[model samples]
Target: MQDTTMAGLWALGLGTVKAQSTVTKTMNASIPTLVVLANLPQLALSVIYVLVNRLLSAMAAAREWASFAHSRKGLRVTVPQGQQRSTLWLQLPYSFAIPQLVLSALLHYFVSQSLFLAQIAIFNARDETEDGGASVSSIGFSAIAIFCSLLTTGAVLVAVVLAGLVVRSEAEDGT
Candidate 1:
């Protein structure tokens, strides 16, 4: 599951690059170097996201097992010694998993939209040629998009904390 999630994120990054290239082509602009530099932080974020996701999945599974054990008096839940029958998705509730998936998608979309390559044509009055002036291309940042991406990131972090808290509370109550 983790590998699949990481692969999806990589595919999303590639798609964003392709989309940016298309936009740049339409505007007759070259991609800025800063765009490549910007990806480093995104890569780091993706790594962090994967790790946090793994942690949250484990917590969710523990919460599920705790609930099961608590519901049945004098019953003990033991961790699997080897291969497990159920996957992480199966352990997580739909209400918890669905929103996490949605938030992750929104986060990626907003992050990709936040930075863009933009071209502006500079026209000169002195030049009478059809193409009077050169075009200036640069990396542009959208404030609103950045803000939204940050908000989505915050939401993911909050979800992790909430999940951890739920697991901790469950463990305490089960004990």
Candidate 2:
């Protein structure tokens, strides 16, 4: 329980950090359109939600492992040769979740950048069809990138929900 609590606190701290960073960036940014700023709050909320929930999942796993190691269900993870054999079903939330979230965040950021660029490109393309910029190509690429971003974020959200389930089970078992 101590371990889980500590881990949860750390998770909360990291989640706060992610939220603060998003707010900081949004404040410093100079987006001209309300549409761009409109997206920031939702994205930042997502990062905070995922980070906190996933971290709690990881903490639950850790606490369960630690308790299993200490108590006797007649299960010793390590062998007589002093080989540690635990962590069979453990999933490090940060290992998978954080990177996925970061990647998704980056892609969203770029998605907006691409849209802005594409808008400018459209203006230019109308005036000059043969503009040397990779304008049209970028539009296609960014569309694909945004699709992939949604896919990744959706997957992560599902994983986090499952992780939360595991954590809840651990809590019930702990009692």
Alpha-carbon TM-score of each model against the true structure: 0.60, 0.37
Cα RMSD, model 2: 15.4
The lDDT, on a scale of 0 to 1, for candidate 1 is 0.62
User: 153 in model 2: Cα distance from truth in Å?
Assistant: 1.9
What is the clash count for each candidate, in the order shown?
Answer: 0, 0
Model 2 clash pairs?
none
Tens-digit per-residue lDDT, 1-175, candidate 2? 2233544434433212222123332343344543455456457756765675557556656656655754544433534234444443335435545655575566555445323311223335367644465222111123333444566667656765676676666666763
Top candidate (TM-score): 1
| Residue lDDT tens for model 1, 1-175 | 2233544445444323332233333343345565664455577667876787678678876776777766653332344334433344534567677877788788877877766655556656765434655665655554556667888888888888887887798788984
Residue 51, candidate 2: Cα error in Å is 7.3
Compared with the true structure, all predictions reach lDDT values of: 0.62, 0.47
TM-score of 1: 0.60
